[model samples]
Target: MQLSETGRGVLVSGASRGLGRAVARAFAANGDRVAVHYGTRADEARATLASLEGSGHVLVGGDLADPGDAARVVDEAAEALGEAGGGSGIDVLVNNAAVNLPHPLAETPYEEWAALWQRHVSVNLLATANLSHLVARRLIDRGAAGRIVNIGSRGAFRGEPDHPAYGATKAAVHALGQSLAVSLGPHGIGVASVAPGFFATERVASRLTGAEGDAIRAQSPFGRVADPAEIAAAVLWLASPAAEWASGTILDLNGASYLRS
Candidate 1:
């Protein structure tokens, strides 16, 4: 519950680039000792670590598709953050790593469709669940308060026709966060999720310049998509003690692009 200017230890997964990198920077700027976790981009992860405002940031690399690797990543992050913060365990866990692949039912073959579904479910849902469980267990054991912020997608509430698995997994993520919130609340752990619409990140830069750019922007009344920093700011706030009462909430960061009744 004590996250001061000398902030808490935080772990940001898949932080080599895009939204994950932005989230990492936000926490570091708040004086948190961050553990930047990446799947394959070592150089980019190192760059993220270097871009952190405060010192004591570390880099962790692992493929979350494997349950073992997911557990190891959390363990390594906890160890590194604890060492950096005078043996204090990680205070925040950001589940931002995911596999978002487009597989239109009309265009994709059955074999490829199955593979894509497996990949998406494994990384987006299973991996996140594993990480959350590990982190929650650690916090409970230590009798410490912590936070878990899941990075979901607007497609969960709206729709992703081309990437049905992505949408489904994100929906599952939101539900998982709520379930965890209820279960972990008594342990002083907060769990929440943010469902963001299209953001202008490196991954979708080309899409923003393509023929569908205008349509995408028009989805929001602002006439533009979200910026990475905006999503990062929401995440930073959600992971803070100030948002403890907001647990079990699946916050919408879609810029009014999609509203559900």
Candidate 2:
């Protein structure tokens, strides 16, 4: 049975774990069909798909590092949802997958740095752009508007002491979201961003310095890191009807940790 005559499709990159899984689950909970994409970890991806709250979800497997593979992933995702029983086109597109390269400037190699840039830019920037274009075309053809949510990081602006490449790339993501908001708004599509502070993900939990991490914790007015669900909550709102008027805005989900206060 078709989820809908136009099965509201959502393509979530990196849906296997962490913040991506949280975002995927949120979309599923709201009855929007989702395509779970994962690279290298098919088992984990399958587990996530199995745990989703809604039905009509499909698992898409591929590595985003390859240009051909990247293009295929989005096409497959959009197609999977359509096969589930819809043709109205993708209603929501969440660009939640990004690479975080944290090596210091001098310590990293020239080629290493270049590769990091290429990987991050290709996955974080180019692939996302391609998907946006495809979805926008589909949405415009169907004469229906949609939503795109780009997950960003505080490191985008904070200019952290290390990870120069990651900082700069995320900064680009911020710009991309804004530009899409402007270009797509007139076409009936909405683009927004979720700039999350240090969430209590395994990545952050493993990096916490005994004293330094504690200090970062104290820095937050809440004295703790944000839960992934909190970030997911912001995403759910942005994709829902309540957030239609909230285009081009980056909802800060950090616990005031990096606030200027």
Give me the candidate number with maximum lDDT.
1
Model 2 reaches what TM-score against the true structure?
0.91
Best by TM-score: 1
**lDDT tens digits by residue: candidate 2, 33-138:** 8888888778988988999886889898877767678778767877778733556446788887777766677787788877877887877777677777777777
| Candidate 1 local lDDT, 1-261, one digit each (tens) | 453434688989899999999999999898888999999999998899888998878899999989999889888888887743557668899999998889999999999999999999999999999999988898888778889999999999888999999999999999999999999999999999999999998888888876699899999999999999999999999998888999999999999999987
The true-versus-predicted C-alpha distance at residue 169 of model 1, in Å, is 0.2
Residue 59 alpha-carbon offset, candidate 1, angstroms = 0.2
Candidate 2 residue 99 Cα shift, in angstroms, is 1.0
> Which parts of model 2 are misplaced by more than 4 Å?
1-7, 83-86
Q: How far is candidate 2 from the true structure (C-alpha RMSD, Å)?
A: 3.1
> Each candidate's TM vs. the true structure?
0.97, 0.91
- Regions more than 4 Å wrong, model 1: 1-6, 83-86
